[model samples]
Target chain A: MSAVGGAAVPAVDERVTRVNPLRRAFTRPEMGAVAGAVAVWVFFAIVAGGNGFLTLRGTASYLEVAAELGILAVPVALLMIGGEFDLSIGSVIGAGSMTTALLAAQFGWNIWPALFVSLAVALALGAFNGTLVLRTGLPSFIVTLGTLFMVRGATIAITRITTGRTQVGNLDEVAGYDVARTLFASSIPVGPAALPISVVWWLALVGLGSWLLLRTRFGNWIFGVGGNTASARNVGVPVGTVKVILFMLTAAAAWLVATIQAVNFGGADVLRGSDREFFAIIAAVIGGNLLTGGYGSVVGAAFGALIVGMIQQGVVYAGIDADWVQFFLGAMLLIAVLVNRAIRSRAMGGRG
Target chain B: MSATVSSRVAAPAPPELAGTTPLLEVRDVSKSFGSVIALKDISMSVHAGEVMCLLGDNGAGKSTLIKILSGVHPASEGEYLVEGKPVRFGSPRDALDHGIATVYQDLAMIPLMSIARNFFLGSEPTRGVGPFRRFDLETADRTTRDEMAKMGILLRDTDQPVGTLSGGERQCVAIARAVYFGAKVLILDEPTAALGVKEAGVVLRYIAQARARGLGVIFITHNVHHAYPIGDRFTLLNRGRSYGTFAKDDVTREEVVTMMAGGEELEELGHELEEFARADGLAAGRLGEVGRELEAEARG
Candidate 1:
């Protein structure tokens, strides 16, 4: 024991202890996901033949399709890390797409205006969910769950009444359609394969989310709010504000995904984004964002999305029933959650 | 202990009095919550380099007084003076701005946050421009490690969550934070109540350290035994009223205990215990039985 500033020194226990335990646990999710990914690749390669499963063409196809889900999962992961849920994100996508389609196709608005209006609407919807949750002090799960259905219903009713159909198209005629297409639909050539523009957004968002989660004061507040709201408040971290900001970010991501999908397909479907929120959440949890909050990583979440993408693509590559992808994902989600719980327990010294 | 006290009395007054200026002053502050009078017409002063021990049992208005001083709740009557000037606090932040920091029994710390993160939570250091602005991780880490080291806490890692630290270590961290943030007065609320013997000693040493740094420390604790050893002045409260404030050299530990127990109540309890012992006539070891009798008397 040694003294400093006249304060009594704490005696060192002299007990053998593990060093860098947190670093080990913190990177565990990515390591596990990466290992799972490689195992999946190898399994598919053995079964589907190297040319069919391990080719650059196959990898590019998997990454391109995974890009959209990855883009949405990044912010969803952030929301989960902040200790909240956004079950309405899928419907927010529907709402944003409908807003863009209705404005551009029926109202003859330019794509830029339509996009702005749609994003603004998405922001408002997010703020509404946040306000209700904050005021009621209810779990965000129930609040957003109710909003999911309400938004879905409103999208269907409005689309049918305005267009006499459940779908809207003709967005290609809008000004800035070329810009939208180039950003959302265009592909970048990588050797013999091309990667969709969505992959760029996914990678960019992953980088941004990682930076925000690990290198900002806002990031610290997120962990504080999730870990212990009472303590965070006592220290003046503005818990409510942090939660509201998370919800808004989720909605913004929803809008971005909706824009990409609508422009790439040149239409909007009432059922365009159903069940995507669950997928994003599963991806986040698998990536290692604790469902209970306080411990998680954005990079891990992106990896979780990559795992899902690989499975979705690998099921087809191996000539397995594509329907089995959902079952496989469901099983993987459960196993990931269980493993995360075990790792979390060990890291926290077995305390809840 | 008695001999130590006699020697302390024979020694010259501590060097703390050399400055001869009160750092914080409460002038007849009174507060009431609706129908309940929580605190009434209390006055106290803490000078730099002095530990002013506030002693009371539960519900003795200790919490109310602390809340007023920490600006959690304002006084409904009387005035609170800092540096001999009357002032009112709008919130805890205002008190903090005035260099008054309160460390409650339940320390305000996010248990899952890293020790360095918790140390610089609200006022994190950042580098770069807007959007590019990022946390100054190296500075935060170095400063937290240095500050903890200054407080005699050599953590093996700065990135470990504070939840892993012992109760005493957590208190030391909070105290060090207040001192580092330029707090002139530190108001501690029962910091050692939940700690073990050794942990409590660690905290008491920090209190002395803070006093030595010329910071006024208000130490609230129910254990007169703990306070008697480190206190420069003692103020006892009973049933929301001040018993009296005394300079440490003027009162003995036993006298302080007697005052806290209410001498009349203690006499009545002693009589009852004696009656019970006489009626039973089945003593379980003389000293042990007497200690139990005294404990029972104090409870009454």
Candidate 2:
């Protein structure tokens, strides 16, 4: 096929295939997600405007939830683009927060040391997942699925054994809790609404992740390893290293998310972050990231998270059943993947 | 076919390349995996600005020979030379660092990535200093376009995914990448074997383009038609042993095919198949038809 804009340009090199600037925009992984996000926003605004879905406070309410999931979805998208998955992120949230809550509340330790040690525990869990996947050569899907159960089981057993309860409290009364809250759970006033600090963290991660994926040498390696592991290895790309790093990053993001949730709730429950792993994946998939790996964008995942937030908040605003949020989410994921397939094909065909 | 093929092995270089050192040379190379011999006493040379076509069918030790030359495996017994100095490569990267690049059949390209990105996959070029440094997109794009142009392809943009390009174009991109990275000897593994006739023709033209650019090319394939047109020399292999190297002018297309298929063995198989065709009718008729083609090729 001839290039999309081949006819518009005067002949200089007759054989040269012209690249249309507009078509190039369609090639970005986030393009479809951005379009879908805007459409979702418009739909909600039209249907639920009288219910205050269009108000500044309503925006803040949804963004607060979006930012929380965005933090996890961003890294998950990166990992998926690198051709792997971390199904244990939901467990990581539980484990990380449980460690912090256990040290601070049950053991009467200060919150600062509790959080620091929890960070270490979280990072260690990440490294463990990465090492296990790499060493065993098992699909990250199955390996992380195992970790999802193991880590969840460990959190439950350890919490029950230590305190005779499946949850921990009194973390808000622990020393150093104020300072830790100021850093993680604090909010910023924006016009008529107060924006949660999680939004800040989410935005920072998007900027950092984007720069990493599009600009850095390692970012280039991530795309290469994800796109074609065998081909990338043949050309001397360190395929294992890229994937392992992605796994670790996904775990770290989960830990960050867990800390925010724990601080916001003033305690950690063994059941906290349940089904979050699936939600994070749903966000990535809805953002137009391919499940097969190699072709995706972190920004798209953030928008996926945005769509999720809208559905969760919009159903209540529109006076629909809250339970239908799950149904809406599943439907969005299916539509997104179908939309993404068409966009990806058009991009590759240079017919965009 | 029964001969060991040692008697016919050329002595490293031809008369035309006698004084000057060839870009890549293998002398009496033999390889064995435990008790099984993969290659036996093979010798060949590739000079700059020439296409050395390595022709063979299945189980002809082509991949083994490629592995040796590309440094995936060390030679069990032989000397591999570059510019008259013998060397050993521990890995493919070592061979690449020494200016020997292999464009394998799959071509080592990521389909979803931009052409420029795939062109600089493992060894990305970056500008700036420290943590803020990033991939030099301008240079990568410009260089990809220029290198492709050198291979006789003109592109308006280098950001198009490699999957969008035709198979032959992808081959050219791989070749251009190897050339851009300073490859002196290019070992192309069945570049045109997966292409349509027109696409194969396109790749053959690129091979000629590579030769004109002064690179020593080692093109491996079973298809003689694809090889015979652009090759300077043909080195035939049969059942892991070299049948000997023949200059393009010294052998006709038929003779090259015959030697590659083991001429005497082919004639015997053809007669046997013809006899089986008399006993078994329909299915064996297909076999007899192949036998007739083999008999004709064997006679040439």
Candidate 3:
């Protein structure tokens, strides 16, 4: 209602109303992550003994593995936040690696060209997945699942047909191996500890993803699409386009991760990158991303990857069976998801 | 009475013959889905600086006409004119490109995104060169705040997600966006349907503000109460056919309500109520009370 007698309008008055401090705290994701991070450190330190787990070398090892997984998780988290998924990313990694090896080993292509071809192939595959999901109006999960199997089958068939083996090698001959290794595989030593280049890539990607999600239009579209697609459409957003781009971005990250693995190991396995979709999804969920869409953080996702990476190395450091990693990861995924849901429900004033 | 007189005296010259033509004109448009005819020869015109309310009951083809105008579906037959030139839109984008924007009841905003980001989702301003074209955050925040302020929404912060805003604030933001983007014709679909009385008034004021800025506004609603005061012209629809389109001076609120409920339905309902009252042995003088109840039921 309009105000009378020069009285301030109630709507205007409400705008100036002081927000409840509790409500303000509940609205932010950063506060929750900081608390989670502290809890994680405390838990790991207690389990591994103060000196063993908190050592620089132990931290570097965790950072190394987390960085590699974190790079993929960032884009995967973003895609999830945008209300979509890219199950085919695991296959894209194998596809990228195989392409790189095929170009360099079989065709005598330079490393730069091989890597370029690999990335281009990955982008094309991503575009295909995006287009199919958009055109068919199918769920991204189903569409990318189809692409996942199709690309995996294609990768295995091609690798066996060309090399008469289940694996591709001789990528070392590529002209850009030295540069690739330096960027993706090389390590930086600080005093007695060394940090892998992949860790740096992971950190940079996390930073970029965080900025894009919080401060950019693309980030807004992600939240919009995830929150309510119908509502997003009413507001003039190109919902289909945003979804397609997110799928492509996730695939691109997969390509980057595969490149690092290929260079680091000096070969590609037909079964390489298996179950990475689950890992990336779990990491994202653990990091505070809602599986139903609309809310998430890149830092949270990276931290999720850190948790997984730490558990992986922590098992060996504690002299426990390495095979138990999968069991722990599975349990952690469920617990993290439950925790995330609980936190989200609480944040939304317990409506759920 | 004095307010009505003031409004009349304050009315500017028609301005219909000025440089700008009516932004959107629907000339006897009709549509049918399979066996059901949704809209039958509905003719309406929207000029800049005026509010044209499309009033109808359920099944009156209000949704059908809006779908046609907003490019959700094409009219089965009849002409849609833009700038006095005939045209047909294949999709929502086509309508948008023609400077027509549709704000549906749901508002189409992403609740998880900040207000500034939702305001410029698709057409974000960018800084930097190729391969590094970053979003222009400062511009988006400043413009979103300024535009909302102009529309009488003084947001506490542009950084808050749209979901945090009240229903009325969201509608205002959508309208401000459409206006800011240079929409000549603005079609609002049941914007106040889900809002409370106060929130509905907030949206209505913004609608008036939009009209004042010289944008043709098509305000669709089922509530005659909401339509009567703000609407300059009213078009009534019933079962896919136009009852009539009248200027504000030509019809009263009661007539519009009566028209929406077809004459036959009203008569039938009245007869049923009288018979029931007689059968129940109500006093003769209580007939007026019975008649009023029948009228209310018929209107509803």
lDDT of each: 0.82, 0.87, 0.80
Candidate 2 backbone collisions, by pair: none
Lowest-lDDT window of 10 residues in candidate 1 chain A?
A1-10
On lDDT, the stronger of 1 and 2 is 2
Candidate 1, residue A90: how far the Cα is off, in Å: 1.8
Model 3 misplaced regions, further than 4 Å: A1-26, A173-176, A342-352, B1-20, B32-36, B273-292, B296-300
Model 1 steric clash pairs:
none
User: Candidate 3: how large is its RMSD?
Assistant: 5.8
Question: Runs in model 1 with CA error above 4 Å?
Answer: A1-32, A39-51, A349-352, B1-21, B27-42, B74-78, B237-244, B255-292, B295-300
lDDT of 2 at B81: 95
TM-score of model 3 (CA atoms): 0.87
Q: Which of 1 and 3 is the better model by DockQ?
A: 3
Per lDDT, what order, best first?
Answer: 2, 1, 3
Ranking by DockQ: 2, 3, 1
- Better model by TM-score: candidate 2 vs candidate 3: 2
All candidates: TM-score: 0.86, 0.91, 0.87
lDDT of 2 by residue, A1-352 (tens): 1342233223457655555768768767888889998998898998898899999889999999899999999889999988888999999899999999999988899988888888888778878888898899899899999999999999999999999999898788999889889889999998899999999999999999988998888999999888888777767777777887788888888889889988888899987888898999999998888888888898999999999999899888888889999999999999999889998998888432
Q: Which candidate has the top score in lDDT?
A: 2
Q: After superposition, how far is residue B143 of candidate 3 from its true place, in Å?
A: 3.1
The sequence of per-residue lDDT tens digits that candidate 1 reaches over residues B1-300 is 223222433212245564565778886788888999988888787888889999988889999998899887899998788887888987677888889988888855666677888888766799999998988877887778789889877776676678778889889988998899899999999999999999999999999999999999999999987898999988878788776677887778877776676755676666666677777676634644674667554543
